[model samples]
Target: MFTTKIIAVILCCLLVSSNGLQPSTCSNQGDGNYGCFDIASQGSCTEVSNQPASRDIRWPHSGIDSNIDWAIKCGDIIAYKIQWFSGGWSGWYVPGVNDMDTKVNNGNGLRRMWSYFYDHTHSYIICKTNDSNKLRGCQ
Candidate 1:
């Protein structure tokens, strides 16, 4: 009888502990910051400069799975990030120039796309005249 009681207690303890343990999640608080459920946080975004700048884009994954699709112009660059329940968050991966257009799983946690400017200047100007001819490929 004592052995059966001890086994029941152990099983109860395991159930309680399992209920308390849950998977971590990252949430985009909308201020360019990804807030984590268990850990501290992922990161944030910064302004864009002509010299070189990057911004961190975040998405939350509670249950549903999704993907993020983006496009870039000029000479900007981009990268991706993902996190799993087994391992920690993955490092930033810079995709090749020809592989710019792609989609990533949203459940992998908040993803980031970085845009860079190789020019030595910290500012840029886009000239758009009223004429259709002036509508260049600046868009």
Candidate 2:
């Protein structure tokens, strides 16, 4: 049983890393109020506002997903496009891994990020969610 559990965990981790899909800083926290998602510089590359890691939580009015809001990296155009296409996530998300598909609810965040790489491959991206929650947005 121990071995099986270990193997299962390893497989899960493998699947998650298969596409370099980094999980959210805070795993599916109900509403950022409890713990807002923070965008990072390593993975899910995002736009920056004033200083590094000092982006405003209120970018626009609010993401279309519920009351969840998205704080784009200051002026990252790709970030804006991704959010525009995916409706902006209050937290980090990946398609074909954590998310069921990459066509619904804007599951292309990871894909777009990964595909946006100069060589069509990115190490990671940064996504920060202030008052966003509800995993229903993805798989």
Candidate 3:
């Protein structure tokens, strides 16, 4: 009876572990690179390459739309279409702009920072790649 009980307990543990109990998120490449879904289909690579390199500024804002909000919470990679400082070529979206900006602004600060920009930038979207947390399912 004792042996049977032990076996049963072991089986239960295995079952629990196999069900992906921990919070896991999927990746874009399937190798678990990014937390947000793959936006490759939406031309992420092209968009990133075409963006002009510029000095990006970090600004904090709140109450961003849902699409941007989701990415900030769970995205792995950041991409952006940066506009140059000069006139014209003013609006475009960047994938990881918020993440990058946040990192730069914080700069080893002790305070915990929450991403707040979602509306100030135009056409910016967050790609939801798979993460170990499994929060988002296959898209």
Query: Each model's RMSD to truth, in Å?
Result: 21.2, 20.0, 13.1
Candidate 1 lDDT over residue span 1-139, tens digit each: 9999999999999999886343356556676456645422322223333333223222122112112212223222244443323435444445442323144544543222222122112232222223332224533
TM-score of each: 0.21, 0.16, 0.22
lDDT of 3 by residue, 1-139 (tens): 9999999999999998877433356545544454655444442211223323222222243222324334334442234443333433434433334333334433454211223222222223345543443346333
User: Where is model 1 more than 4 Å wrong at Cα?
Assistant: 1-5, 21-41, 46-94, 100-139
TM-score of 1: 0.21
Top-TM-score structure, candidate number? 3
Over 4 Å off, model 2:
1-81, 85-87, 94-96, 104-113, 116-139
On lDDT, the leading prediction is 3
Please report, in order, the local distance difference test score of every candidate based on alpha carbons. 0.36, 0.34, 0.39
Summarize candidate 2's per-residue lDDT along 76-96 as a digit string, tens digits.
Answer: 132221232343322333432
Ranking by lDDT: 3, 1, 2
- Range of the 10 consecutive residues with the lowest summed lDDT in candidate 1: 59-68
- Order the numbered candidates by TM-score, best leading: 3, 1, 2
